[model samples]
Target chain A: MQALTNRVKVLDQKPLTFKERLYLPAIFSGMLITFSHLFKKKATINYPEQKRPFSPVFRGLHILNRDEEGRERCTACGLCAVSCPAEAITMESAERQKGEEGLYREEKYAAKYEINMLRCIFCGLCEEACPKDAIYLTETFAPANYSRKSFIYGKPDLLIPDPTKEPEAFAKAQGGIKAHKEKVR
Target chain B: MTNHLNLLPYLSIDFALLFEKLLLIIVVVTGSLVVAMYTTYAERRIAGFLQDRRGPNRAGPFGILQPLADGLKLFMKEDIIPTSSSKWLFIMGPGLAMLTAVMTGAVIPWGSALKIGEKVVSLQIADINIGILFIFGVVSMGVYGIMIGGWASNNKFSLLAAIRGASQIISYELAMGLSLIALLMLTGSLSMKTIVEQQMQGGWGGFLGWNIIYQPLGFLLFLICAFAECNRTPFDLPEAENELNFGYHQEYSSMKLGFYLFAEYINMFISSTVMATLFFGGYDIPFVNEANLANHWGPNIVALLGTVCLLIKSFLFLFVFIWVRWTIPRFRYDQLMDLGWKKMIPLALANMVITGAIVLWLNK
Candidate 1:
């Protein structure tokens, strides 16, 4: 009757002898192990006070890229939205006016690109699928919210305040997209 | 050998004074709570010391603000009620742990009686005729809280752990209770105050008085039982992390979880104090006549100082509990049962018989 659970059942160990059952020595031994760990470096990291170094590949908040001239580079391409498995992305494409060609480098541009923060699985597929190299995910994880609706990251919100925060990253994003666009032209 | 001096006339009469028991009861319970809260802070500091890290320094100056920080954290947390749980029982689980933890201190003689302006006040809450039994009774009832909470959790692991815990505690309590029967026979009184007063203080030709000397085997058995009672390692199978996640409080969160954890440390503190009081002569010291101090400083000051000494001993015992907790490994369920029933019970029985025979031969 007792063996019905799906959980992994450990092997049954033999019982201790009467003297062996005198738990003092064994209990003392176990205490010694914990005491050793008491000297071991604690696994607990004070999250707020001490920030752990994140990996370069660490995907965090999604950002819409800006080109070398500090101009918004997203060209209303629906590729990111279409590729997102979580359906976290939403965008409204608008035609770029005659004077704004340098701003977008495309006739069609994204007027309102919003990613529902709640649905985002942080899968990075949107970043991967963006042909314009307009979207990239940063290593920022500070998006806890009281309401689900507040998580929707629109164009302005998704834009990074400072790509220069990671200089190497800014140059990389700019170089990759500029080359890709020049090749297309 | 030091002649048996009776301090009962002083203690019993002083305790018999009206309103004294009530005050004793209040101080012990409330004082135990304060001590219990601080014990947690001490445990953290010790663990930090062993690890070469300063623990909990963010709360206040050197984290003197830690306990208050903890209290505030608990208070501010969301009090969650599970839809599947028996709301009443869930609420009552930590409540039971807390209640049982504090209640046992009611009869502990923190100090001997001291005389005030016009009256004498005993430093204990109640020195009942069946004091040992009263402690046993209350201590036994504490298990119900865990049982109820675990059962109500609607979790198989909790239920199993609770059953394991309940069985282990019940079996060990028998041995713990029996081990004391020998001590009672020697003392001929159940009142804790009388028992402490009875100890031949280490005066009069190197008196080795505390029951720990007379009953070394009993002390061994009793300490093991105390460890098991507190659900500490290696007897901490009740909330075995490998099997039960976070044990009975697995589903609990926020302040509810805080209450469960806090109540456990409090139980440990109270149990250690009880062990200190029962076997180590409560608050009495060898060669230090509490009565002598009473004569000079008056009874009230004597009682106050004695109470402080008892607290120091209890705190030392509490440190041991924490020390042992970080020292031992948890026992498996079967191993726990085997130790309690097969080993502790028999050893306790044998010790009692040997003690009985020796007393008989000496008297004869």
Candidate 2:
């Protein structure tokens, strides 16, 4: 048969030589190779003590964004809930009261928001659908927990720390994603 | 000359002799067990290094406490007994394996005799006339453990693996025995102590008397057979995890399984010591006149140093064992049998015949 491609080559089907049949020299050479590997640097990272750097575009847990003044960025427009492929997001909208201007960034605010972590595919579709930069995917993943019910994350769980009250925590939480965004810009 | 000096004490048994023997036995058994434990750790570490990875560096520094942690885990595990299995025979298997492995150490000479004041203390637990034969008897018995365990399990895989192990050991034993016969002819005595003493005397630079120089072919044959007998990789078809799934110990659980694994390491340790004693000059410190050293630094000190030398030699053998395990892949069943019967047997026979002719010619 003709060759399908130039890369195809015929294999040598010759019998083993006397030295090859002996096996000791081959075994010795193989042992030498493995012995040489003893000095080679190991590939292990000693995990828990050290961790590898995640990629710049790595998306993990959901974080509800807030403005610099610490007021909620979400207007309860339900765009993120509609866009979520996993159907994990849910919210209840409420009309902001007269005295609640400090808490709400818009007249309409989310009274309750929940994301079922088990159901969330972490595809970052919800982050893309948000018009007000209200939601973002942080570089920190969800931790292991016992009960199934605990996986249903409430607004308190997803919300970023208020910048005015906990500036260090908010900055630390936003550090990786913000740096990555600045690099892209 | 040295054998005569050592033999006189065996004629009569006193309280001191009995006490000395008991102490020696305790020390040897405990020492072998501890060495076997560390061997598991070394095997893993060496295997990891060969693969360009770190293995078991937790629990303690460099995983020094890994064996202890493993032992504790095995003990803590549930002891499961298969309902269909023979309870009595199933229990006896690992115990028999461990017993035979430890029993072979009785004849190996740890060091030259230590002289403390007017009394002389022999380092060996037993100086039997048929020392090599006793070792052979014990090593052959080791297969029974595998056989019984496999048979008792009533599992098809276990039984098949057992048969493979038994046949492999039996086939290799022939080559091993034939190889040793050539060395026995040269040494002219079956006693382990006598063999070492012979090697220590009348050779160039004090180290040329080792059996490896005279019968390199015999040593090679014996070493290959030892790997087979120990059921290490390349010959570990019986415990072929991919094919047999724990093999003979498939039904075994907890400490019983631990016993089987521990027995293998002990077997490796004992075989290494045997190889060192048989070919590498057991307790005979290379390139040094031990008698002259004893005069300068006391007999006890020299004896201790000699023991240390034997240990060093055995450890080197153990390292080679681990190294080979990592380097070679397991042989196919047919290939294994072909190597044993067609290759090893014929080579060993040729080696023995050549050795015999040389001995006869030299004597004439």
Which portion of correct inter-chain contacts appears in model 2?
Answer: 0.78
Task: Name the runs in model 1 displaced over 4 angstroms.
Answer: A1-185, B1-22, B200-207
Per residue, candidate 1 scores C-alpha lDDT tens digits across B1-364 of: 3344555445555445555676667767767777778888998887675555667877777787788788888888888887998989888987887788788877877777766666666667777878888989988998997798888888888888788788888999999988998888778898877777777355541136788878888888888898898888778888899888877777787877877777788788777777777777677654567667667977777667667777787888887787876666677777788878988888888888887888899889
Tens-digit lDDT string for candidate 2 (B280-363): 999989989998988899889989999999999999999999999999999999999999999999999988898899999999
Compared with the true structure, what per-residue lDDT tens digits does model 2 show for residues A68-180? Answer: 77889898899999999889999999999998888879999999999999999988888889998888887778899999999999999988898899998888766755875
Best by TM-score: 2
In Å, residue A16's CA in model 1 sits off its true spot by 8.9
True contacts kept of 1: 0.39
Each candidate's DockQ: 0.22, 0.84
Error of 1 at B354 (Å): 0.6
Provide the TM-score of chain B versus the true chain B for each model in turn: 0.90, 0.95
Off by over 4 Å in 2: A183-185, B1-13, B202-205
